[model samples]
Target: MSKARLLLATERRAIVGLAGLYATRMLGLFMVLPVLALNADHLAGATPLLVGLALGIYGLTQAVLQIPFGMLSDRVGRKPIIAAGLGLFLIGSVVAAQADTIAMMIAGRSLQGSGAVAAAIMALLADQTREQVRTAAMATIGLSIGVAFAVAMVLGPLISSHFGLAGVFYFTAMLAVLGLVVLWKLVPPAPRRRGHRDVGIDRGQLKSIIGRTDLWRMDASIFSLHLVLMAIFTAVPFRLVEAGIAEPRHGLVYLGVMGLSFVAMVPLVIVAEKRRKMKLMCLGAIGTITLSLLGLGVAGSGLVALVGWLFAFFTAFNLLEATLPSMISKLAPAGAKGTAMGVYSTSQFLGAFLGGVLGGFLSQQFGLSAVFLGVALLAAGWFVLMLGMTAPKHLSSEVVVLSDEHQGDALETLMARFADVAGVEDVMVVPEERTAYLKVDRSRLDTEALSRLTGVRD
Candidate 1:
C-alpha cells in the first residue's frame, strides 16, 4: 500500500476502536431512557426532579471534564487517560448497580459521568492522522455514535426487563472492561509528541474570531442544533411507548427509523459535498426538523407521529451532525482547533442537560403537547439563526510541516506558499505550532499537481 493508503487503514482501525468504546459508554446512559420514570419510583426516595437530575448529571460532568481531560491527555498520554476514565466509569457503574437509594444511584451515576473519554479520543485521532484525513476519521467516530445510540435504544428495555436496571449497570461495567482490553490489545501505541503549548486567549484575537458576525452565525447554528435534539428526545421515547410499542421493541422502532434516516441522509450528504451545497443542505435539515416537531405536536395517531417525527428528527440530526463540525474546522482560528471544539462540545452538552431537565419538568407540569411546543420553538429559532450562515467553500487543506532549523521564516514561507497555490484562498500559520493551514478550492487546484509542487507524495 501507498503511505497514504496505509495511514488511512490505520485511521480506520482507530475509528473502529472508538466506535466500540463510545457504543459501550453511550449504551449505559441510553438504557435508562425507556424506563427511567417508571423504574425510578421503586427506588428509595426517588422524586421526579431527582430523576431528572440523574438523567442529566452525566452531560453536566461530561461537559465540565472534557477539555480538562483532553488537555491532560497532552501530558499523561491518551491510552493511560482513556484507561483511567474507563476504570472510573466501571467503578461508578458498579456503585450504581448496588445502590440502595436514589441518592446513592445519583452519586454512582455522577461518578460514571466523570469518565469523559471524548476529548481523549479526539486527541488520539489527531495524533494518528493527517489533517486532510482527520475529518474522515471524525466521521467514522460519528457513525459509531449514531449506530451505538440506535442499538442502545433498542436493547435498553430488553436488558431492563430481563436483568433489571441494575443489570444494565452491570452490562455497562462489563463493556468498560472490554474497552480497556481493546485499548491494550487492539489500539496502536500512540507516538510520543511535545506537549501542546498553552494557547492563552489573546483578547484581540479572540475578539476578532468571535466578533465576526459570520462566525457567530455558525456558533448559533450549532447551539441551536443540540437544543432541538435534546428537546425532541426529551419526549420521543415515551411517545414511542405510548404508541403501544413495548419496551423491548422500542429499539426496533429506533433502529428502523434511524436506519431509514441514515440511508436517506447519505444521498443528501453526497449532493452537498459533491455539489458544494452544504449551506443549502444545512438549511433544509433545519426546516425538516421544525416541520417534524410540528407534526408530532399535533398528530392524532401514534404511527403517524412516530414515522413523521423520526423522519424529520433524523434527517436534521444527521445533517447537523456532519455540517457543524465541518463549519467549525473551516471557521476556527487555524491553530486553536482543540480550543474551538472544546467550546462547541461544552455548549452541546449544556444544551442536552437543559433540554432533558426542562423538557421533563415541562412534561410533568403541563402535558405532552407542551413538551412538543417547547421543542418546536427551539427548532424554529435554530432555523431562523441558520439562515444567515454561509457554506464552507472547500474541503482540501494546505499543510506545512516545519523543520527544526527553519522555524524562523516558517510563517513567511507559509504565507508565500498560500499565495502561490492556485486554489488557496486563505492561510493561517502558527509559528508556535510549526503548522500552516490553508483553505482552498479543490476544483480549482489539481491535487496531484499541488502534491508534487509541495513534495507531499500521496
Candidate 2:
C-alpha cells in the first residue's frame, strides 16, 4: 500500500491542456456576468428582463446540447466535436460583439451555448487518463473553472470599463480562438478509442443512473449552487454601486474577496479529502452559502457588509465547486459515469438560466433585496438536500478487458475470483461488453495479483 506518481507525462499534458482549454472558454462566458446588468442599459431595448435574458440565454442552449454533444463524441472523435463547439462559441462572440439590441445579444449568447463541449471534454479526459488518477484530473479541471470565475469577476468590469460591452465580446471571441489553438497543439490524442462507461454516456444505463437518489442529490446540489450564483450576480453589482462603489472600481472588490476566499478554500478542501469527511464538508459549505445569502439579504445595504458576505459566499462557492465533480466521479455507477456527468452538466446550465430569469423578475418587481432573499431560500433548500446524502466511499473505479476464453461459466468463475481478492468491494462482469468493472480500495488493492488472475495487462 504505497503511494506512487499516478499521472504519466502524457496524462499530465492532457490534464493541463484540457484544464486550460476549459478555463479559457469559461473565462469568455463569465467575463460579461459581473458588469453586464450595469452596462446593458446602453444597448437598444435593454429592459431589466432583457438584460437577464442576455445573461442566461447561453445556459438554455448549453443545457439542451450537453448530452447530445457527449454522445456524438462517443461516435465521432472527441477533438472534432470539441473543435466544432468552439467554432460556435467564436461565432456567438462575434455576433454579440456586433449586436445593438438586447434581442440580438440573446441570440448570440444562445449560439455561444450551442457549443456544449463540457461532456465531450470530460469524456476525453477520462479516455486519456487512467482510472486511479481520473478524480485528480477532474479536480484540476474543476479548479480551473473556479479560478476562471474569480478572474472573470474582476477582469469583466475592468475590461468592460475600458473597452465597453462590445469590446468585451471581441475579447471573448479572441479567447475562443486561443482555446482552439490549445485543443490542436497542446492536448494529446487519446491512446485508443474504446468504450469507457465510467467516463462516457451510456444510453442503455441512463435510467438507472438518473434513478439513483444519491446521484439526484448531487445533481440537485450543482443546480442549486449555480442558480444562487447567477441570481446573485444579477443584482450584486447594482447593489455595490448603490453602496458607493463605482462600476470601474467593482474589480477591486472582486479581486479582494476572491483572493481571500481562495486562500480559505484550499485548507478546507485538503481537510475534507484527507479526513474523508466529504459529506460533512459539503453540508457545511452549503450552510456557509446560505448564511452568506442571508447576510446579503439583511446587510447588503452597506459596502463593508456586502463585501463581507461576498467573501463568505465565494469561499463556500469555491469549495463546493471543486468538491461536487469529484464526488460525482466517485459515486457514479461503474459503467455510467458519462451519462451521470451529462445529466449533472445539464442541471448546472439549467440552473444558470432559471436563476437569471428569476433574479431579474424579482429585482424588477420587488426590489434587489427580494432577489437576495429568494436565493437564500434556494440555498436553504440545498442544505436540506445535502443533509440526506450518504458519504462517498474512498474508492476508485477500474475497467478490465476480459479475454475471449473467459466467457459463460468462466466469467462467473472470474467474478468470484476477483471478489476474493483483498480490498475489492464490488465487481460487475458484462459479457456483452466483455469488460469487468471493479470498485476497489486502491491503497490496499494488489493490481499485479488482479492482473494475473484476470489475464488483463495493465
Candidate 3:
C-alpha cells in the first residue's frame, strides 16, 4: 500500500522557519523593483541605460555564484554558508541605502546578489526532512516566494513614497537581519548534511542534462520569461506615471492588479494541472503575453488602457512563472533534477540581466513603446520554438534506500523489476548510494507492486 508520512515537530519547524527565511530574503530583493526606475532621477549619474543596469546588476552576480555557494555548503556546513550569504546581503543593503550615485547603487545591488544561498538553503531543507516530507517542505518555500513577490510589489511604491529610495534599502537591510534570526533561532539543525542527488547539483550530470534538446527548450523558456519580466519593470513605472497615477498611489494600483491577476490565475492553473493541459496553457499564456505587450505599446499612454493591459500582462506572467517550474520538474531525468534546476536558475538570472540591458537600450534608442514591441517579438519567437517541443509526460521522482543484499546482479535484477511495474517511467540505481531513483506517473503507479518490490529480500 502507498504509505502516508506526516511531518515530525522538528520537521514542521524546519519547513516553516526555512520558508520564512526564504520569503524574507526575497521580499528584500523584490521590493526594489517597482520603485528603482521611478527614483533614479534623484541619483547623480543616472540615465535610462544605467538605471536599467542598477535594476539588474544583482542578477549577474547571483547567476555566477549561486551554484558554488551550494557546493560550498557541502564542505563547510549549510548554516555557516547561509549566515555568510545573509551577512553579505546586510552589507549590500547598507551600502545601497547610502548611495547617491547610480554606480554605488549598482555596486551595492551586486553585493546583494552575491548572497546566493538558494541552493544551499534547499539542500538544508532536504537534509532536515525525510524523503517523504521534502516535497511538502519545498512547496511551502515556493509558495512563500510567490507571496513575498506580491507583497513586495505593493509595499515598494508605498515605502518609496513615504521615505524615498533610501528607506526601501533600509527596510531590506532589516529583512536581512530578520532572515538571520530565523535561520539560527527558528530552523532546527539537521542531523547531518550531505550532497543529495535529487536536491543538489551533480557535476557529473551536467553534460547529459545540458545535452538534451528538450531540457534546452525548458531552459530557454525560463530565460525568456525572466528576461521579459525584468524588461517590463524597467518601463512599467514610467507608464504608470504617464497614466496620471502618482508614484505614492502606485502601490494601490499594483495591489489591485496583483490581486486580480492572482485570482484570474488560479482557474488557469487548475485547468493546466488537473486537466493535463500544461503545454496548451503555456503556449496560450505566452501568446497572451505577446498580445498584452502589443496592447500596451499601442494604447499604454491612457490610464484605462494601461491598467487593462497591466492586468493581462500580470495574469499571463504569473501563469508562466508557476507553470515553468512544474514543467521543469516533469521533464528532468530521475536523478538529475537538481542539476537541471541549477542550470535553469542560472538561465533565469542571466535573462534578467540581459533584459535590463536590452530593454533600456531599446527605450533610449527608440521610445518606451519600442521596448514593449521588441519584447513582444521575442515572445512570439518563443511561442514558435515551443510549438515543436514534445509534450512532457507527467512525472515525479521518488527515492528508495536499498540494503546490502540488493547489490551487483541482484540490484540490476531489482531495477529491471522496477521498470516492469506499471507507471514507472524511468529508474536509475546508484549502488554506491544504495538508493533507487524513480521517475513515476503517479496517476498510473501501482502502489502495491512498488511496495512489494522495494521491500523484497533474497
Candidate 4:
C-alpha cells in the first residue's frame, strides 16, 4: 500500500491541541447520557418527558447556534468565540451541579449547548493546517468524538453511582475548565484569520446546499441516527437496571458491549471503504438496527439476550456514525462543504431533541418496549429514504489560496480554468475571499498542474 501522507510537526501539534479541546468539551456533555435517566428520578419535577428533555436539550441549542457561530468567527477572532463559548459551558455545568429539579437541569443543559463552538473550532483547524492534511485533521477530530462517547458511556454510570448525579455535573465543569486551558495553551495560533469555504459556513452557499436532494438525505440520515441514540438512552438505562444490573454497575455493561461492538465494527468499516460498498454497508447497518430494536422489544427479558441486542444496536450505530460524515464529504459540493455540514449538523441536533422528547413520551405513556418500538419505526423510515440515495462518488476537496495576481481575473474565468484542471470535477471561486475550492478524484489528479496552481502564490 502507498504510505499515507504525514502531517508537518506544526500540523501535528495543532491537531493534538484542537482534538484535545474538542474531545474534553464533548466528554463533559456526553458523560450524562447513560446515567441521567436512572438517576434523575430523585430531582424535583422529574418525569420521563422532562428527563428526556434534559438529556437532549443541548442539541436544540447547539443546532440553532453553531451556524451562526461559524459565520461570526469570520468577523471576530476564532479564539474569542471559542473562549466565550467555553465560559458558557462552564457556567452551565455549575448550574446543573446545583440544580434540585429537572427544570434546572434542562436550563443548564441548554446553556451548555449554547456554547456551539464546533464551526469556529473547525475554522481554526483549517487556518492551522495546509489543505493536504486538513481532511486527516478533521478525521482525527471525529475519532476523538467517538472515543469520548464510548468512554462517557462507561464513566457516566460509574461516577453517578459513587458520587451522585451532581458529581457528574461538577466533573463536566472541571472538564470545561480543562478544555479552556487546552484551547489557549496547547492549540497553536491560527496562521490566518479569514473565512474558509471548505471548513467555515458561507452564507452565499446556503441556498444551494439546502437545495441538493442528496445532501438533504445525508442530513436526514444523521438526524435519524442521533435521534434514535438519544431516545434509546432515555429508556435503555432503566432496562439494564431491570435486568438486574445495579445502576452503579451499568458502566460495566457499557464497557463490555462498546468494546466488543468496536472490535466487530472495524473490519466492516474497512470493507465499506476499501471495497466501495458504502451503500450496501449503510443499508445493512440500518437493517441491523431495526432488527436489533425488534429483538430487544420481543425477547430481551433475560440479561444475556438484552446484552446481545444492545451490542448489535451499538455496532450498527457506530458504523452509521462513522459512514455518514464521510458520505457528506463525498456528496457535498466542493466549496460549499462547510455550509453543507452546517445544515447536516443542524438536522442532527434537531433529531436529538425530538428523539428525547418523543422517546420519553412513549416510555412514560406506553412503557419501555414502546420506546424501542417507536424508534424502530423511525429507523425503518430512515432506511426507506436512504434506499433512494445515489451512491456517493469517491471524491476529496482541494483548497487553493489565491495570490494577488488573481485579483484582476474574473470569477467565471477562474472557475472555468479550475474546472479544466485534470481530475477536478467541480470548482468554486469566491473572489472576495481570494480562495478556490475544487472537488477531485485523487487517482486522476495531475500533480504537476496542481503544483502550478499553488506555486503561483508568492
Poorest lDDT segment (10 consecutive residues) of candidate 4: 1-10
lDDT of each: 0.71, 0.87, 0.89, 0.88
Off by over 4 Å in 2: 1-9, 130-133, 189-192, 401-409, 430-434, 443-448, 454-458
Give candidate 3's error at residue 10 in angstroms: 1.1
Best by TM-score: 3
By lDDT, rank the candidates, best first: 3, 4, 2, 1
- The sequence of per-residue lDDT tens digits that candidate 1 reaches over residues 1-458 is 44653556666677677667777787776676655654676779876556666666677788888777877887788889999889889998899888878888888878887998787877776676666566566767777777776677677777877888888889889888999988877777786644321121222354566666666676666666665655555567667777887766766777777788878888888888787788899888888888887888776457766676877788778877877777776666545544556667777777766666766676677777677777788778877877877667665544555545545664677577656877776677667766666666767866665565445676
TM-score of 1: 0.88
> How would you encode candidate 2's per-residue C-alpha lDDT over 293-371 as one tens digit per residue?
8898888569889999999999999998888877887788666666788788889999999888888888888888888
Pairs of colliding residues, candidate 1: 154-251
Candidate 4: give the clashing pairs: none
lDDT for each residue of candidate 3 in 263-375, tens digit (9 for 90 to 100):
99999999989899999999999999999999988885799989999899899989988888888888999888889999999999999988888787888888889989999
Misplaced by over 4 Å in model 3 are: 1-4, 403-410, 456-458
**What would the TM-score be for candidate 4 when compared with the true structure?**
0.95
If both were scored by lDDT, which would come out higher, candidate 2 or candidate 3?
3
Candidate 4 Cα misplacement greater than 4 A, ranges: 1-6, 403-409, 456-458
Q: TM-scores across all candidates?
A: 0.88, 0.92, 0.97, 0.95
